[model samples]
Target: MPALSPLCLACAAALSVPGAAWAQAAPVTLKEVVVSGSRSERALDEVPASVDVLTGEDLDGAQVQDIRDLARELPNVSVKRAAQRFSGVSPGGTGRDGNAGFNVRGLEGNRVLLTVDGIRVPRELTSGVFGSASFGRDYYDLGLISRVEILRGASSALYGSDGLAGMVAMSTTEPAELLKAGQTFGGRVGLKLDSENDSRGVGLTLAGRPSDTLQWLGSVQVGRSSELDNQGTNTALNSTRTAPNPQKDEDVSVLGKLVFTPGGGQKHTITLEHVDKSSEVEAYTGRTTSATSGSVLDLDGTTDMRRSRLSWDGRFRIDSAWADELRATVGVQDSDSREVTHEQRTVSPTQRSRDVTYSEQLWQGVLQAEKTRALGGDWSQKLVYGADVTVSHMDNLVTGTGAPSYERYPLKRFPETRETTTALFVQSEFATDRWSVIPALRYDRFELKPRNDGLYPLDAASLSDSAFSPKLGVIFRPASNWSLFGNLAAGFRAPSPLQLNNYFENPFGNYRTIPNPDLKPETSQTLELGTRGSTHGFQWEAAVFNGRYKDFIEELVAVGGSMFTPADPLTYQAVNRGRVRLHGFELKGHYALGKATNLRVAFGQTQGKDTVTDRPLNSVNPAKLVVGLDHRLGDWKLGAALTHVAKKSTSDIDTSGTPNQFATPAYTTLDLSASWQVTPSTRLSAALRNVTDRKYWEWTNVRGIAAHSPVLDAYTAPGRSLALALVTEF
Candidate 1:
């Protein structure tokens, strides 16, 4: 990819002024919309935080198919596929099990919380109980999403648990004024082809609203992608080689949603949704030595997810002097995952063996109510109270030709685990003519219970804890076009079930992980300051933040011999560490050259260090920069963007007999796209990703590969791929 030329920088600077025009058209104006901030419609400038809104039109113009693709265009965000050597899990949990995780300002995984219509989705996990390759199975189908709102920075004080990093809220289509007038339908069909992987796939989506008070959206997609063959797979670690020419894989997904609203004086709404995904692939382990041929493995997996929600919202006027608006929401989610694998030996056909089949079910429920009141004096208060409960059951069934054919290993069913949390939060906004002060507080109590179903011997059955978090912020409007803000907040995360109950093997030898029943919750205190403003054709935002973490939870290696009747060789455990400090900055802005052209740029950097070790934290993120140019003509729109990722240094570890720590090299990529209005109600578009076919490792997967690994030879990022689609509405 070509570097940003000095001329481009000069152009950007010159275009930053109000009323500047680069072509024969008027400057573009910022649209006024409220869903980006508060639940109620309010101007974007009224919100005191780092927020970005991507409109439905923007998504269509970009040909965005998944959340990962959508993250690339957002400010201070990065998304990458998971490492191949790391076990087969879906990349960045697609908002499920939390495996395929997304990194923002260096924070990844559960640190960042994702929500659909205010409902939290579970993260996906690996068979070993680690965060799944991606968060959840593709629960986020772009076809059903009408808009997306991203709020960056710590928000745990307002949202419980998983909001420590930030929050991503996706809003699905509903039957509002935009669709209530008449029956409307729309759909898109597209195909993509890649050069390096020789991969090909197609996708389709359809949605419609038939009545004023009802809307329904449904989508189904299936695609086949060729295995990524990188030369770097020829490495050996502890005599265990990586995979080469890994078997290709297939993915299928289905999503449906129904939304209903009553047109009575009393306001009420309900939504029901379901999502499913499945994948199958053959696995290949790269050759250990030059003389040995690789092994071929077979694997099959399926994930089924179901969610139902019923909510009611209404307002009551107690005397005309004051009024109160109330909202109550309740939801349930059922998720199940199953996987099976078969390994084939290279030397003897009969030497084949199979590992145990793994399966688990997750059930969750949430009830919440929020009330807003008008308190006369330009002062209003909002109170929110909620309770959440989740139950999970895990079963490990040993099945295969190797198992005793007659007396199969008894199904090992771990005790069912249950988690319950209740929280009370309040936020008040008091404003004068030119300034606003917002103060918020949240109190949360969490309880966990583990039931032993005769699967494994465990003594402790339950644990509980509580926390109080607070936030204070102020926003000042120095001028009508400018605003300045600052905030101080506290965040926390309770231990997840897997973190407290998982027992797995280590790479060293026959090892086991003992659960730590006595673990403290992780907490962080953060301070942030920022400014935003818009003038005619120019809009800009910048923020700086610092945070301190306490009782940080991390996986620790136990030195002593395993403690078991059989006395296993090695052991590992989860422990609470001392403290960590992190700080970062984010800057994003856009300038309209004219009605026909515009330019936008965003950049972010974060640094985290352990107070005790005085070293950078593991997987700390690197700096990132994205620049784009958009142009429009008669019924046509075009865009080109360049993204740069900085190098990252791994955390320091002294015990490593051979330290595998190093810094990832920086790289850049380019993307181009175009969209055409075929008719008043029809549109067509195309996009080219990795335009230069440049190879680079996303920071998240760098450690899984070898040193000096060729970018293309590692996990390739859809090299030089092209996609085209058509959409029509009536």
Candidate 2:
């Protein structure tokens, strides 16, 4: 090596410090690697943002039912599904269950961006007159994932819109070609059962390399889960009746992928992937009477949902200065949901039936280039840039069935809508010895066009919006085992088509939604500070973030002003609101107690308020803590965990309107897990959740309704559930 420059020498000196090794120095494996946040493949300590990487081992030990289940051990994270407590979407438990969406640091819905294998997941949720649809309705089958990386805070600089809170990305499993030597063909089969809802699932995975230039992986899973009921104390005659009952869900999914590589001066790898999934849900609330049998309410509705995806990825690596690697991807996704219901009264043989269909289709393409170069002696840098385009289309149509005497719903709640998005992003990483810096920028443009079928007030709608997000992060390693980090990032979300131009009317409900074309994108600026260290058989990370949101887009109750008011029906128009402040802190750590035992703790707290109104924001999460211990004995591992959540006052639940939605009391539950490796290729795992069968409610799971209603039990937490998992590979 030649003489290094002064800056290079300084960098070398900083890196030379001897510190306790994190997971970074370990031999890199396809299945086990602690990652830096996305945009690069760096170690955790090398990244400035708050990043958490869960290994396959960590995921399996958690007995995760899905990706959402992993939130128990992570700070400031939760999941959301449909709730029946409120009319459409509310807090508490929605009697309905759909694809579980992510909520990070108190922000849920389309605010959190989700991706798989670096590809953006499509937004499936749309808005309609009756009920708005959700954006992400497809779940990442856990069985196919090898690693998951969670980046907390604004990530729009790297992922574009929908990353207002953070980004979650998972890497799929590799083919058998990357497996240990001498394994020509291998597969894993598993069976799991949950006591809470008598849920059961079977998973099968197969990977193989039949030739030197080809390798492949395939997975299949099927699951069924019943309703999770409360202590049954709410069924008393005096309790306020809840409309729809708990729902039963059955789901099935299949995934397949193939990879091929060829030799030469330039190596190229091509991959093809596809996935199909469907869920059938039965609304089993059954016929029930509230306080008294004053109204005849018949309940028998089944919802059928189907989603599919197909993708192609190509990569080329060559020895060059302009670019070291070029990667490209093309993918498509389609999702459809249908629900049918009928209610009849014998008094006059009056019948009401309706068929509802909500569907979305999307196509996208991405191209990226990566380059690495030495910057004078010890300093080096990696530059990554990418461009992507996406087109999304949605359809929401409804029709009446049965007798004409019954009232009929609107034929079109939400009109045929299309959104086209184009974006260019770039990120640079410069590192020397003890100092690492990253700056990223992304520019996004959205073109939205919604069709008018002669049903709404407008003939057609055309809108365009653009945003620029920027982020800068720095990491300083003062000593071998400790590092200080900080990040300033900007994020934004464009208004959904429904919010921009939706016209829905429900004569019976006395409410209507009028579009607001003047709406602006929701934007945020966040500043974060944190420190992470690992030494003396212990590791810890702590970070605090403060953010301000501008142009907050929300559905506000409109009384008048160029919109339908008391004359028509109460109007809930999507409009931009005043500024809001969001802040939160998180702490996590683990200590190795001897070589066979480990103890860990995770705590998180968040607060959000409207700066203009000085009132609490409904999007905040209650403070929570999770403590756990694990012991490993050769091939057997035993662990226990306790989750405690603080109670919330009326302010905690976004009392912008509803108070009961935020009504949650303090509660604690214990969980235990045991896993055994019977043989080199076989493993068995078991978990006892809510060992006390405690009755509690999570503010994030259900929509808000009055607290004293009988529906409370429907949204209550599951009690005394035992889950067991058995997997064998050969």
Candidate 3:
């Protein structure tokens, strides 16, 4: 673990200036103000890490549409739900394989790293073994998010390589951000309803300034969905459905922004976005015939997505004197994923279809410089430097036909590729009074090239890698409410060009998929300890974390027998699995039982394994608790929430051999909410989720099937729901 140069990070940011003064220690005011974990702007406890923010009134009091409803309000997070897709089955990495999205602490599908507004969000790698790709293409539009920044641990120094399990930034909605100053032009309208997926939605917002150097904001959202019924208990596609199983989803979103300041104010911004989504399902082939195969299969699926982004930002307050905020960014993004499959059989009948599409096009750039001096008496120092770059291009295509057909068709399920990533970062903060210290560094480089034309069987290569991550943190505030913290970090992940050269073929299980141009890259090292406090009205936070992983890159299979079937096909490899051990504990609290009442609590626990087959490592998330209560009265506001889950007998599908290893009981759920203003611009809200219609399954939505298979595990999370909303503003 030695690698940190750039003149030792500019001589450690010039020895943090100095530190020998007194008087001038009064600062620590935060109710919020954070910017994606230290990319700038901080106040949320002076950002040392471990962050979670969701505003816009907490996404309108948790009516938040996706991101797995924030694993019931944070703690090791989760959001993996994408079921129903079978050929030889297994798309269980949750829908459209954005490649395992947002799993954070326990390690997300793509090891977490998603962003919008600050760019970076393009990852989906798969060579189809039925499906698996993750990293949030979760179809944005949390009502054009106004804020969402969640950073847990191990953030590759400062975002690089899937962030090694950390990062989820999403921002939109600005226009004098909660203006003041005789606001000019404004608008808002919203309507929503959901009764277990009979969904319907509409939203729009606009903001304006028109002068004083301009400002603008715009947003639009639309949604429709039907079919989300389950809890018929007997599980497995709701106990072999026969009818009433067609599903549908449609969505649309758009957002725009513009800002400028002109004066010594120095600022500029421009942003634009778009989102379109589609989802479909219809297939209850709960299987019942196939005795020597008399035929009785049926399946249907769809996942269509389109996303776009454009950005430009500039901020400067530098008239020289060593800089004090000079930031710049340029961006472009595009993502598209389309997967459709259909199969039908009725009794010795057959008809089939398949079409796969994946696309990504991205470009990004960033530059930053920040400075704050004054090192004598009353110590002070703040420095941040940055440089970032990303370039991407990926394409995959596969088409189909049936005798139960799929013998093949130009199958280049991810051959063409080009990737590039670059980064350089530095952070330093040294305060005085209460004491504070933070040191950070980052350096990254990644490149992959493969422009397969000969339809690849081999021969099309190039790879490059580099990484250096470091972080050290400390904060102590002996009194005045209190805080104590500690941290140590390093993270990494790389090796995806479809896992180092993917090649797959199955003219009917002859076996194939071997390409590991010596893959290696997956590392993490973490240590964290924390405490936070506030008096009287109460507020608290507690943390303990540990993580160490290396090499990690599982997936090994080579025919010759070990048959997990491809109809007699099996040949996959991508090794390098050595160490891994994660540990966790977290607690959160809040209390204000006086002026309007309030109380809340959160708890978490997780454990990991894989010290060479001692198994267990699916990010482990079990043992959780949440409790909340709220009341306001005056304008009406009320709330209640309870969540508890525990019981997961180790994973990798029950001890390394993953594939729906059954048994994952332990549940408790209840939620309720209310809000009303009903005048002064109007407002209304409601939410009710799983108020005891319990029957749950959340162990990262277990996935791996085929044991007595007839629909099998994971995908039973959504039973009992209701939500409503209405809003108007002028």
Q: What is the number of backbone collisions in each predicted candidate, taken in the order shown? A: 33, 16, 15
Q: Give the lDDT of residue 694 in candidate 1.
A: 77
TM-score of each: 0.81, 0.88, 0.34
Instruction: Show the lowest summed lDDT stretch of 10 residues, model 1.
Output: 89-98
The residue-level lDDT of candidate 1 at 720 comes to 70
Question: On a 0 to 1 TM-score scale, where does candidate 2 land against the true structure?
Answer: 0.88
Cα lDDT, model 3, residue 93: 29
Cα RMSD for candidates in order? 10.1, 6.8, 23.2
Better of 1 and 3 by lDDT: 3
The candidate scoring highest on lDDT is: 3
Which lDDT tens digits does candidate 1 get at residues 503-580? 554333456666778787787777889999999999999999888888877764474565542455566667787588
In candidate 2, position 252 carries an lDDT of 75
**Candidate 2 runs further than 4 Å off:** 1-36, 81-93, 97-99, 124-128, 131-138, 234-247, 264-294, 346-349, 402-410, 454-457, 506-511, 559-571, 659-662
Best by TM-score: 2
